[model samples]
Target: MEIRWVEAFIAVAEELHFGRAATRLRLAQSPLSQTIRKLEKELGVRLFDRNTRSVALTPAGQAFLPHAHRVFEELELGRQSTRAAAGEVYGTVSIGFSGALNHLTLPPLTRAVRQRYPQVTLSLAVRVVTRDGIEQLEQGSLDIALVGLPIAPSSVRTRLIGREPLGAALPVDHPLSGESAVDLADLAEDGFITAPAESGSSLQESTLRACVKAGFQPRVVQEIADPYMILTLVSAGVGVALMPSNVAGIMPSASVFVPLRDEPTFMDHALAWRPDNPSPVLHAVLEVAEEVLPTPRT
Candidate 1:
């Protein structure tokens, strides 16, 4: 019920040993045991299944662990917000960026936050994919992340900030590969390699929508998860990849990516965060990002 009770529970839950948890909390073992007993008594459940040999969390304890961490997160947020309201905006914020599209706003956003709040520290983590960023955000390891639209969890809030135009990835020897610009309909009959529709990836959706608008449903020959693999498949003459054209220099040769000539389809990029997060440091960085790259509300 008390703050010290929550602290004791978390320490014990993490260490799984009364003595170790007490040492971590800088409290005597007897008192720490008493704290756990009091918490268990109040909750009317055994949080741990322990014997002299080893210790482990009970089913109830395992379920309660995440909620306990959330309690701490909320308290920390309150403290940070209070400090920020007092004109002391100084806290660490973790940001996750997976793709190059986020780079357009990262530098300017970082500079603006540094100038406005000299005390804040920005922590950057390069995630391998948008799903990785979204997972980190849900786990509370990251304050914000660049994610594709329609992420799985509704708990995450998003603000659209950028849109990268899509293009066709075709084999070098393909007839239309020589064109300066290609239309989506031109590839209607061509074999297509796309991301699975279940992934909710903007790349696949944009490609499909553009193709449908261009008067054809693509002949999908393969569905690959990784965009790089999709490109590699295209390079091998498997199928044309209608994806973000901006990723030209990263992959190997043997394929040509050209701009879409018809109504341009774009892969959307957005900044995603938990709405429950009250960290003033994250709020400050988001403010700067909103200003640096503004987009129409979706």
Candidate 2:
């Protein structure tokens, strides 16, 4: 009638001796006998041939053995499948990022994830900047994120992965491009391309601060969201922009990427996830990110 009763039936059927079956099941002989009796009563069939000297199975009991074993095996397999589905080694992850990450981080990040978690399907969304990415994360849209700025929300957990030094994008024919290294101040009179102030971009803020430190408030000529567009503007001599050194590697043609004289206004890159919604897969991905990011030099 119950699974325990089925187990008792199987035990006595296999051992043949009442005392031995009871011992194997860690039960008293009386209870094991009662359980077998109950199972036989429920099934309305005799399962054992009993004599004073020995016990043997009925044809029905022999027929039921394989079915009983199969039932238990199927149940265990179902439990194992559920656990595997919940494990870090399985499942899909969705990630969002500011456009800059496409050029500076995603290529390597994608390669690493593919190599390590080939079964984990990764989905990506291109965003304007850190603020946009964080908003998506908070809305339950992103499982993980690669953000370019500091995340202020206490509910959002993060890890600093790497830092890239700020560099300037300029036209090859521009006056200052001839210099081996250009001071941020040298472009004080130049028209500038920048992301909007309210965009919450750390790079925009850092670039502005660098200009102020170099002693001028930059004259804005264009406001663009995508880094590629910024490079296009520079290529057309529309204006100059400050970006991470990695951006230079993504350019299709030679513009000019000069190290800022200050040489290290770094844009910090971070891996972020929601603290409220913890995920084992996301945590594993974060670990991979931390492991792959370039290490800081002393």
Candidate 3:
């Protein structure tokens, strides 16, 4: 009947050992066993088959497990919805972003949040790598981040926004500029620029893997921290660079954009927040991002 009894029943059922469940729940075994007894008494059924050496769930307990899980899930959802309606908008949310994300996703995300929750001040922290974003999130400095996946932490709560296939950008005068797409192997001898590995970007690692998959190690002509600088260098004919398809719209120039053939891979972009401290503006941001970008580029 009570939430604590439900919790106690669920815990013991999961552990299948009263003492172990009590230890896991941080309570004395005697109290836990008594709580389970009370739960069984209230339900008017034996929920467990217990002896000195073993414990097993009764048929009724097995039947009730799914219902208990659903109850907890619904309770949490109700709490979040209630908090959302109350305009819990005074918390400071620190947000981090990769460079190219500003052009592809930030505009719509910002507009929606500003319109919906003006009181929740967002502190923008732009960084070049996904690891930087993850570190900030773990340190409690960042409440949210728009990160390129393959770099985000598994522990963080993430919602996918979009993905863009890797594309080649070269100056109009470059030898391969006339083609609509190029094979990664063909650019083996060409000078390449990418985000440096030291920046802790998984995109940087993916680039390397892409080249390796194409049976070559890219000739590193330069390592630039910002996506804009890489585009600038490519435009200057200093070298070629691999960029997300969405970045092409922002880097409008004489650079010819072509999708990679062998490594037709994409960088996944997502909005991440700490699971424990959910951001108040996140739902609005997700709505805007979904509306603006329902699907990734082909």
Which number leads on lDDT? Answer: 1
List TM-score per model, in order.
0.76, 0.68, 0.65
Error of 3 at 292 (Å): 5.4
What is candidate 2's lDDT per residue for 187-247, written digit by digit as tens?
Answer: 8889999888888777788788778877899998998877777888888889899988878
lDDT of each structure? 0.81, 0.78, 0.77
Q: How big is the positional error of residue 40 in model 2, measured in Å on the Cα after superposition?
A: 46
Candidate 3: global Cα-lDDT?
Answer: 0.77
Model 2 residue runs over 4 Å out of place are 1-81, 85-88, 294-298
Q: Give the Cα-based TM-score of candidate 2 against the true structure.
A: 0.68
The weakest ten consecutive residues by lDDT in model 3 span 278-287
The candidate 1 region of ten consecutive residues with least summed lDDT is 97-106
Which candidate has the highest TM-score of all? 1
Counted clashes in each candidate structure:
0, 0, 0
How many Å off is the CA of 185 in candidate 3?
1.1
Could you give candidate 1's per-residue lDDT for residues 9-115 as a string of tens digits?
Answer: 99999999999999999999999999999999989999999899888999999998999999988887788889888888888988877544455657777788889
